[model samples]
Target: MRSFTGWTCLSNPSTNHLASLASAWLLWAMMATSLLAQPPLHVDGRRGPYHDHGRHGGPSGEFDLVEPTGAVTGRISLRRDQLIYRHGDGRQVVYRRNGRYDTPDGQFLGYYNTLLARVLKFPRSGFGHFLYADLDDFTPFPQASYRLLHPVGAGPIGGPIVGPWAGGYMTHDISVYGGGLGLPWLAPAPAFGWGMNAGPLGPMPFAPFPLNPLPLSPIPLNPGPVPIDTRRVALPDLPPAKIRFTNSSQRDVNVTLSDARQAGLSKTFRLGPAETHDMKLRRDAGHEWVETYELLSPDGQWITREVRHSIQPQPRYEIVVHEWRVQSVAIDRTARGNNRIEDINMQGKGIGRFLLPPGPELTDQTIDVFQSARAMQNQGTVTPLISDEQIQEQFRPSDRVSPFERALLQQQRAIQQAQQGQR
Candidate 1:
């Protein structure tokens, strides 16, 4: 016998390439012969080849021999029960069940479901039955494109491989069902079928191979425009009007008036943490006048105490004139430190006072008037004014009056005129 290795070595390079091509052709021919030699995998429940078809098999003895007029092609190793089809592209046309074939390279394409059924026709060149028979809209079979053999079966002849696409598989163990397929696999009977049919694998039915798998043809992502931020800042209400007061020591302090009107005034005075101070507010004008007393620190850093009062008219019919007087003002410093008033006391006449009903009951008219006046006072809280004394104290004989001061004085005169006209 000739040595096979020596024969291979002695072959010419061109001859070797031709011989290899010839051998490949021979192998393909043999494969085709083998496929043709085997009887069609019986659909009538037979266990082997050469079995008789059931009476239901159409035209039992008449075998249809489809001739290939073009290139033969097909996917290998698909599921055993899927429906299959062949589609033609371009100028090519598949061999219909009617037994006609046409092609131009892009003509015939094979498609299969899970039951190994031939639902679609291909060119006679395309052989091999699809492994699958059912093509449900849902329930995608990842490996349905081709049949792959299971290694443990009876060599290569037993059957095509039937495993999950990645590494996933159907199982019976409860733990496996819970840990692997999630809760759906553990569900009972018909429910499991429903769940499986309703899952992600159910909806998609398309060609298994991606048309373009390279990263260069990536899916596009779109990001829309960003939103704008709109916000606002708010300010607190204006501070209350300042009231000047003089105590028995002749020291002056400025008090913040909380509410001041003809009826009464309410003020908040902060002594030290634990100190107390006496506050007096008397009217030197009409009976409806009221005042609030506020004490200030020497450095004007703090407000010591706040006092509020309603000045009632003395019962005298004879030109009842009232005067706002500071009987005596004292600071209670026992709680923390010595208390002192920093500013000069303000003494003014014509502060209005009102007569109260003999009984504690308040009249509606009195309440309405008082409320209106209180509203006016609140409005004046933010208005700036200079006292005559302050003007005199700050004025120098050689200095001329400022335009702003002159304007302010004119405004003051106009206000006085308006008040006199209203009276």
Candidate 2:
């Protein structure tokens, strides 16, 4: 082949050079156009926070599928023991849970429950079933989705919620339900109770009542036997007693006073080394004092000290420990430090499926509206049974999903497939 320089220098040099240059530019231009024409490639590594469907990513088979003919706008219900699905070609299909049925050879899709099932098929890999898929909005790969029918308020959803899209199964009403097959758990979720079928457009078959409305009985944390009426009333405030505490001990000390003599619940004062504390004592009733005083160190070791003075009534008193002193009564101790776990159980814990958030809130609202111990425990103990109004709310238009989400889901699924292929 003649070199470009040589060809250009040949006869009719200008014409040859112009023609060659034009052809080269045209070829380059064609290549650029082809590159631009190719569809854009995207790896949906994760769903944006904007498109979160509530079940922490990965396909949760929480949707219903219907072949798109024109559009599917209206109520779609999934009643137990009832079928409500059809294919694009008008062939009917049905969904079965916790079991399996025979479908066509190439359509053995995966299963989904409270847990996220593994991706069962590539968008159209032409093989096994695509567990969480919609035909009109076919997902080329199984992008992670979440469980659609969560037990009552157990999910981040409320009322009749619709899913992202609709499409049909590859075969006519057939499926398989594996129990221990790739499953790790089968926990029971809270339910408000099921209702009668309300015909089509019924995605919610149950009305949501508070889960176990009545709170479980609180465990008894008492250390010793209790008097039928051992409840203690708050002590009335009184004037303080005048006293002068002279710290003669070598180390610093802490002084506290309490009706229950609970160290942590009392007011504390730091008696510094070789410091004299002239103060007023928050009057101690002294009515329950057991004549003889036995002083125990922080670690329960015996301490020998004596300083006595009596006041009022007797007009004199004795505080033998020249340092801070806290009184403690003997407590019933158990093997595990307190009551037996069984005792706590017998007292009634876990009797229901719901609980109040930990830590008591002292907001005025809760305090102002007090429920008697008896009343609160038995309040809402029984569910009011699901109603028709609630069933309608389950799949309301606000919750109805459009096809756009499924499309986005497919993109992520495709990316997952690519990564899996590389692996």
Candidate 3:
């Protein structure tokens, strides 16, 4: 090749030199234009955040597939049980959850490695599989482009490799269910990572810890037995006792006070609800006293009778009469501090299917209010039952019917006639 200096020194030196300088300038301009026309370089190695489908920069959580060329070419939408991969160019592919994928070329097996954030695809022809890394969206390579596997399963083709992108399956703050290629991994993920399906291996069931299994025995926290008291003491002979009586019942009551010392001698005092009465008795017959008290309703009906023979001087007693009383007892058999696994059988079809519906056989026969009241007044423990005539009278419909109800009846009659004609 002749140099620029050589060209300048040729015959007609000035003209030749000018021609060589013009050629050099033209060549430099062409080279600059070509360089400018090329795509921008991604020097940071990190995939830009804008490529995300409104979240992480990956298809694990989204249906849209952002290409390495920053163009959203297609999407992976779910249709029933399979995932449909739709391309912008109108081509389609289907992927099953069992690690089997079908392409335009043929059927292939694919698995994602969450640890490396890459997809390993095995074609139908060979045992080797191609690996497609998670390159930046601005990268020059096309999205579907993948590297050919090494012949002997050597180097980065088959061996496990770790880098800045390793274990960083989620490029952004969002959590992704799967890794690259939007597929499940072949193995379980490590701790503090999102779990993915095991492809043909199915799901990984939870295995109980062998050592230090949870205890299932009941806690030793039962209470002790009740105690019995047995003792006796001599009574002291004393007098001048005081007694207070209260009427806690809803109705008014009359209290009758009598002393054995004086026969046919008694005093009656009326006590209203929540009313209290006090009584003082002197030393009668030298500390040998006998007191009898009786409580009666307003109509002279006996309510309660009590007799007291005390040898104390100033013995104080308080009586309260409540109209109503309630008694209840509860037993708890729940086992506390027990963590045993228990399976509960759920009734999906409902127990109502096996149960008898609400009818007269399943419910108590209703009684008439007037007859029941009469029976309670005449026979204390007897309940009144409704007669057959009363039930038939209550079920009888009225002669009058509204316009809307008459229309419904006419429609029903028409339907019945049509059924009869067809028969």
Candidate 4:
């Protein structure tokens, strides 16, 4: 027994110390088990649960401006045809219904003719005050002088300014004077001349004050090539009188041939790998034979849907069943302007792959995951649908796992693999 400052303790010092140590060991063991139970992460470099990290605008009609690295830095709100952009850096800009736009600096209300704008390397013309014209001999109007507004926020004056336009630049010192509302006015003002600047609101050089040519256009980002969905394609139907089916695949298949029009007229047969079976329906004179066939796996799993074929029972018709497989593939667009196919290894950690179909349509076109699976089902192949939970599990990372926990997970996976191998 010992007396402390505020409370009295009655226990052996060595037992207390051992109790504390056991509590700590139990806590550490629990934590290690938790870490080892976590699933492995995907190496696909995709945005995980933090995809909407900086997302503030949650409603519709509001879009978060995301950077290339998936960070949300700003937001854009849509009001009919107008767009108001606000950045976290205290900058605000508004793109009006007209070609004009307003910013903290000044308003851009002047626009060159569509034809001349194209020659000056302006962006593609859209609907509104500007005419979406083509490159033809038709010239609607000559280039006119733009109205000069003195105050910064004041609207455009009026009429056009016409003069002998030589290549020059416009130098504006609008930040000198103040507008009525304390807004700074542009210095030297602006006079329309040859195109200056590079972007949408680039300054144009006043005529006869030419310095240098306009800067080159910015390069555009190239996303990987678009994948074509083959499930949407409509295939032609086959109509034959008599048919012979050959199991050209590696696995034995169970097939059922039946008369589609008459019930109780069916035959079930089993075909080994590379084996062939011929089936025919009893047809009367001048009558047509409508037959249907379906396939199943050796384990009694439905592989394909029943397909109807019109047969004549005249010439010998043969059909081959090819094996289907699920392959993991990814598109690597690292090379400039080229999309290359790269093989991926799931290794019991990653998720996703393509279900390859048999025959000519399987060229460079890789089918979509879900679509390919459904297509295989329609073609009588047993395919399992990937769940959303499986996808989320693949995105989970094991970085937080300690070395000891990692070793435990590896040992568990090895044991599982061994058990499977033995089975």
Candidate 5:
């Protein structure tokens, strides 16, 4: 029988075998080319199908895949007719019933109006005074204003037939303000007595009062003036702080500081338009740092605004080495199922075979390595001495195998010794 070793020689009797070997070599070359054609790995650890990088694009110029958090800024206004009301009892209320109108830009804005009325009450006595008081009662009143007897019990001998009359009065002047009611100075009470409850003058059957209408003396209508638009006025802006980072740890850093409330700083205070502020920052030993800015408006509104930066450390690399020995092997004879071949070559220094789907192949070989430096390099986990030219150029005579590789080699030697003893 011919020995398998040194079998490359092609003689006339073995030409067929030589042809078969050449065909196998060609198939392997094709498979290697296909594997090499796959695209590069991405930051997210995916192998790409190859995409276009625009003309102006570079690796460093790619948009950040992560979305950033941010803020929005704008303005808002209050409507008119929303009355600010103060009652006689000193209670304050806001009336909001008046409808809003559309702005030139089709936006709905607010509005206001003023209304007035007079409240009257008959005195307890038929002879008491019809006293009038302004908002400030202490102020002097114009003289010669006629005084009428309090309508209470002022008929039939002394009072109207309306039985002892409860307090009562009349008002003809009234108006509305900001969807609320208002009252100006009360008019002088007339001298003629409309007998209480005497039909119209008493009980119920009486015509409305015929008080002499003096030449419509126009009491100048005075509605309180609307407040000035203070929103447009510009407020003072804050100065920016000079910020600096002590550590060169990150590509960007962010720092934030709020003003002390005791410093008369209001929460609404913000950096003015077209203004920039600087802030200083110190490094925290052995920790990362981020800086941020919080802008505020003068009136304490939080004007949405922010600026961010980060600081990061330098890049680094490490070399690793490893070795291994064969433990045991078993020959597989069955060839009808998926169990064709997993591996063949043992004690190799590189990645080995990866199986494909099941097929009917009687003569196939697969190689697998349990601990190979080349496998690590192919996976991009560790730098290999032969292919990592940059690392090789930077190598020093004192640097040797890494600790992990040393341990692996030690284990491999022990396994080899044990195998020899078993033999």
Candidate 6:
């Protein structure tokens, strides 16, 4: 034994070192094994995919901004109908609500008014304080002078509503901004009834963490022979229907066929690879039929929730045809000039939304993870609803905070808190 600054040392230091190494190796192996045990991960990127990497420009250049004219450095919070601009790199000058401000970039902006202050703000003939600015990018996103229209509102969000307007463009600035939103803003603030309860679109977890989306639980699965959760079917009341989906794409595709929600049991049969999924759907009458192809993103998130109107009986076989909902910014106008900056009032604005179709379906393995989620008529395990806290704990959030994001989050929180107090 050797006496060190501490005390006595191992007689054979090599043995001690070997033991330590063994422990570390064991821990690492366990960690890796656990990671591998996670459900076969996938993401769907087919829906109106936005590559916004400076694509689509005149001849060759970074993608042009939709606004043909505007302060080059300023940003319009379209989701919130707010505009902040500056000519050079000086401090930003925010255009006020129900106000119109001209940008050196040749753009005109109008912020909407709620307190009847609109009539005093813009050209009396039309555009009564509804974002009637005229940057005139020639895009058809409802850009008439009358309160400047925007093809807003997602497809009937709560239920079913297909919007006619194409969505806004994908920009690098917003990407960075949205990333900042992921920062943690726990302190309560005053609420000013901002369109987006979470403030401007920040990257996630940072700003727009307003239960914006419930943290999804990853499916617990081993990457081997896919397990079929034979228990659940589309409709339990109706007779069992047979269904099959073949993965015809060169790349592996995940197909999920869920029956119309009714009765006690809603069946969901999951399949993958090139295999044809043989599943069941309720075979009664009424609104019956599986919604076609909910293409998952590469990361296995549910993309579209389109309701299938066509009802039918099985055995049904569907060929998984790889399709894409090309997404690009376009101009939408009208002779009557209506639905301008419109649907936001209906769809709960401020989340920075563009027409988003559910991307392709990569995988629905989470269906297996929902082993606990199966609580229809108590046929399966009755587990408590997963809490957001539990999810955050498991998936530790990052600490990426930008200076601008931090300030914005604080301001939004203050506004939110104030609003709450008034209520």
Residue 123 CA error for candidate 2 (Å)? 3.3
Which candidate number would show the highest lDDT if scored against the true structure?
A: 3
Question: Which tens-of-lDDT digit does each residue in 73-92 have in candidate 3?
Answer: 66544332333556789876
Model 4 regions more than 4 Å off = 1-243, 284-377, 380-423
Show how many residue pairs clash in every candidate, following the order shown. 58, 35, 1, 21, 64, 56
Off by over 4 Å in 6: 1-106, 116-361, 364-366, 369-423
Model 3 TM-score on a 0 to 1 scale = 0.14
> If candidate 3 were superposed on the true structure by all CA atoms, what would the RMSD be?
39.8
* Candidate scoring better on lDDT of 4 and 6: 4
Relative to the true structure, how large is the alpha-carbon lDDT of every model?
Answer: 0.24, 0.25, 0.29, 0.29, 0.24, 0.25
User: Judged by lDDT relative to the true structure, which candidate is superior, 1 or 2?
Assistant: 2
Candidates 3 and 4, the one with greater lDDT: 3
Where does model 5 exceed 4 Å of error?
A: 1-214, 218-232, 248-423
Q: Model 6, residue 46: displacement in angstroms?
A: 58
**What is residue 17's positional error in candidate 1, in angstroms?**
35
- What is candidate 1's lDDT per residue for 178-287, written digit by digit as tens? 11112111111111001112222221222112221111111111111111221222223222222222222112222233323343534533222122344323322322
lDDT (Cα, tens digit) per residue for candidate 2, span 225-282 = 1111112232343456454544443333433323333434544344445565665544
TM-score-better candidate, 1 vs 5: 5
**Order of quality (lDDT):** 3, 4, 2, 6, 1, 5
Of candidate 2, the 10-residue stretch with the lowest lDDT total is 1-10
lDDT of 4 by residue, 1-423 (tens): 111011111112233444545534543443322222111111133221121212321111344444544355665454444445467797866543333322112211222234233211111111001112223535422121111101111112111112211001111111111122222111111221111222222233222222333332221111111111112122333332243555543433334444443565645454545666654333322222222222222222333332233322222111112222222434455633133333322221111222222223223322122232223444433233222444324322232233554464456556545655665
The runs of at least 3 residues in candidate 2 whose Cα sits more than 4 Å from the true structure, single-residue gaps closed, are 1-20, 29-86, 91-423
Clashing pairs in 3: 239-313
